[model samples]
Target: MQQADIIEGIKGKYFQKFGETSNPDKVRTFRSPGRINLIGEHTDYNNGFVLPASVDKAVYFVIEPREDDQVILHAADLDETYTFNVNDLSKPDQAWSHYQLGIIEQIYKKGLKIGGFQTTFGGDVPVGAGLSSSAALECCLLFALNELFDLGLDRFNIVKMSQKAENEYVGVQCGIMDQFASAFGKEESVIRLDCRSLEYEYFPFPMQDYLLVLCDTSVKHSLASSEYNTRRLECEKGISILKKYYPDIESLRDVTPEIVAEHKDELGDPVNRRCKFITEEIQRVQDACDLLVEGNLVEFGQKMYATHQGLQHEYEVSCPELDFLVDQTINDPAVLGARMMGGGFGGCTINLVKKEAVDDFEQKMKAAYLQAYQIDLPCYKVKITTGTEEIL
Candidate 1:
């Protein structure tokens, strides 16, 4: 979007609510980009590689500083209001507001004195669709607060705080990849992150002829949370059992596929299966990085398909809806490969499709999916984009 268009949009939205250009009461605005994990799902927590980019969709915030120590927040989409006092910063029962509150509490714990503010925020990203909408909201709020009080926090600091908010307050044991990508992503490049080391390198994404298409399965398995934790616990168990032999073994990441195979019989069926999935998944992540850097989209897409199969058969994370979507794209001339993305259960199947066939592929896939499931699927075509930045 053009700068003029952005200014117009911000002014229109701001004035419509506050009805003033300048006020003794200060105001600020900020935006944080939503992200799409290009590849390497469920590999982050295992200390493996992941490639993600911030997408075009984002969370926008218009905040006005207040003299008092009380904070007021209003969600444009929810049409709801929330109030929080800095002294009594506690989690909200409503759950959604806690995402914002959690960050504020963490920042204050770091000895930053923050005055209260009223914020009006809205965004277009779909929630719970594996698009990192929650990260968008939390990161934007962190940035706005940093500027509001002259906190002097760097980008990396902000990323850590945002991750802390999600892990401790939101109760999701996510890795740093999501928030890191949202804070530091560059346009047309995929970040190759070493999860164990927190080191990273950027490589140009050679997806020129291809489009990134997301197909929402419209089915969020209620067991996704429990199952995710279970899988994590299982990985930990495998690491524990292996540590008896290899004392240096820390995470499942420390054990290679070869090592797992050597001791495959030592582990029970479930533990061996979990270990196998993670070990192979990590290898695929490395191969994916090499393929993209070498500009081999075909090879990268094949790795993606293999990763999906491992997640389905060994990890047992894929569901019927996910399988159907991948099955539908098996022989598709347009799609090189399709697989379930995110923590699995049901969310979206990320696909590499020929740009020329995107429209027709969408029409055909939608008709077939709806015919089988009798529900319309939401599709998003995304291009690689930069992360959060100040509009001014």
Candidate 2:
């Protein structure tokens, strides 16, 4: 369904659950978009740069403030309901409700008062497809609460809070890119976010002749989360050893390819490989941005292919299925670039394909992918869009 249809369906279910308000002004609605990273995969947590944009797929909400401290939440798509009191927030009966409660916990921890509310929320963002639906939901609700409670928090504050909610409450050690893109994304633009300084700038996405296509592997390997943490630890171990040589080095972001090569023996084994990929990927992001500025899409696409090689061989995050999908686009004239996106192991491969050839590209890939893996591949066609904001 289109985003407008999704919004209309959520609105209908919302009004069905909670009667129409006496004063319509008291009601609020919001859209929080899922994100796609064009390049710079796994570079965020290393305190590096990422090129990301919000997608049309989003988590939407219709909220109305309650007179009391009670908060009522209804998941329109799942047909689930969760209730909690502002005074006594605890573990939610539903797992997905934690994203909302996480925001509330962060608010209370900061000594901010947030009035309770009821909301019906759902979206078309495909979960586990590497589209960052969780971040979308968190940012969507946090933005709505910021306005609903008249809290003095700004957009960046909303981004950080949403990240903290996932890191602390949901126990995910994700970096700021996902939440940042969801909160600050602009239409037809991709953000170059400095994960270290929390600074960002938008580059007009020159996709007028191209299309962004995400092909799902439909398999999230069990190692996705555990190995994500392992990669972080490995990077940390490499940095800790590097500190002996250069005490000022904070993260892989601070080191360079030359520095990594100079200390290859000391960095050791997979640590060296991990740092190699990260340091190179960080530089690639800078190079890619420069190419983007010059409108050198062909070379920019080459950088994407390089990223996939590093992820497949050096970083060791790409699975067989992910690698196969990317390999298919290597020499295809229609496809400019392809890389595995998100926490890795298995998910979607984000591809830059010519708008004219997308149909044939999808058909060919689907046939080959299914013949190889015996699993159907689902492709998502996407466009860049604005970040989280209230619609009403």
Candidate 3:
């Protein structure tokens, strides 16, 4: 569980993969970050807004070029490596390899040719915790490849290609938020991304008296993948209906609370609920941005609570574990806001808590969560950080 915080640790892993005798000068190391969505959830794919920040947790790539068209990859944490020719790449039996292959496939689609390389990669970001570990892996590989090979891919292209790999290759219909945050992150700031336009603005996140913490549920619902796809379909279905009546409403970003309220009968049942939650969550992201500018953490925290209720009741994405974590914190003064993050049938609940009371909050939350589920809850304290970069 050693996070890739230092060059020495990951570099040591590089030697483990390439052998002690391998020439060290030929290798380069890079780190790509995992991201936290502060307010907006399930809004990215809908072409809505999302507020996300890169955290300390990340995936590290220690890579060196190969003389041939062979791609040899080592999953440092898994202690496994898979080799393949760059000439013929496809999804492998190993799931982790998909992200790497997918990125290469994207490069190929652009008619770009790259020689073979070897990389050893691992991440400190906890998997299936709603923090984007997959995106971190994708960003890590893409950034390293772009730099190592002199691909001339700019930052925006890097973000887009990373997302494409996950969408087409990994089979996760994720929005650009994760990859965007990982590639474009800045220290002490959160990026407000417009999924439709792909434009972003940074809002200073001076968490003077609070900390961003995630309470891991330690439960990854089997239905999360299937349910995530289902939810996207539901939103699209809602959009189709709305388009018939309101030609101006192209995506969920264009949806307003008033629009949903007026069309409840036509939108119908779950679709109506789906659109309602998405539209509201989109507005909440905007509201959150303003609060950041105003430095009003308390009101911003309230918006997060509102998002959870929308997700739980309207979006139907919450499982009991997620709800339990958010519900238990409602009355606690130390907690400013709490909500389930990511596509979530099960995952972490992002919490804003008073810094001095973090110890008290953790003590109580651990005891309560353990008693409820017979499982230990893990809390991650994250700091906003800059995007992917070389270790040197």
Using lDDT as the measure, which candidate wins? Answer: 2
Best by TM-score: 2
Q: Quote each prediction's TM-score.
A: 0.94, 0.97, 0.95
lDDT of 1 at 267: 82
Give the alpha carbon lDDT tens digit for every residue of 258-338 in model 3.
Answer: 999999999899999999999999999999999989999999999999999999999998999999999999999899999
Off by over 4 Å in 1: 1-11, 20-27
Stronger candidate by lDDT (1 vs 3) = 3
User: For residues 1-392, what per-residue lDDT tens digits would candidate 2 score against the true structure?
Assistant: 88778888998898888875424567778999999998888888899999999998999989989888889999998899988887776776688888988989888877899887999999999988988899999999888888888888999888888999999888887788999999999998899999999889898787799999999999988998789889999999999999999999999999999999999998899999999999999999899888988988888889989999999999999999999999898889999889898878899999999999999999999999999999999999999999998875
Worst 10 residues of 3 by lDDT: 1-10
Candidates by lDDT, descending order? 2, 3, 1
Query: Which residue pairs in model 3 clash with each other?
Result: none
Worst 10 residues of 1 by lDDT: 2-11
The residue-by-residue lDDT of candidate 1 on 1-392, one tens digit each, is 54345545654565566565335346666878878876777888888888888877778887878778888777777767788786776667777798998898789778887887777787767787888888888899998889888999998899989999999888877789889888888888889888989888998885679888999998999889999999988898889889999999889888999988988898888889889988888888788888877888888888878878988999999999999989989888788878998999999998989999999888988998999999998998877777877655
For residue 326, model 3's alpha carbon misses the true position, in angstroms, by: 0.8
Estimate the TM-score for candidate 2. Answer: 0.97
Global local distance difference test of model 3: 0.88
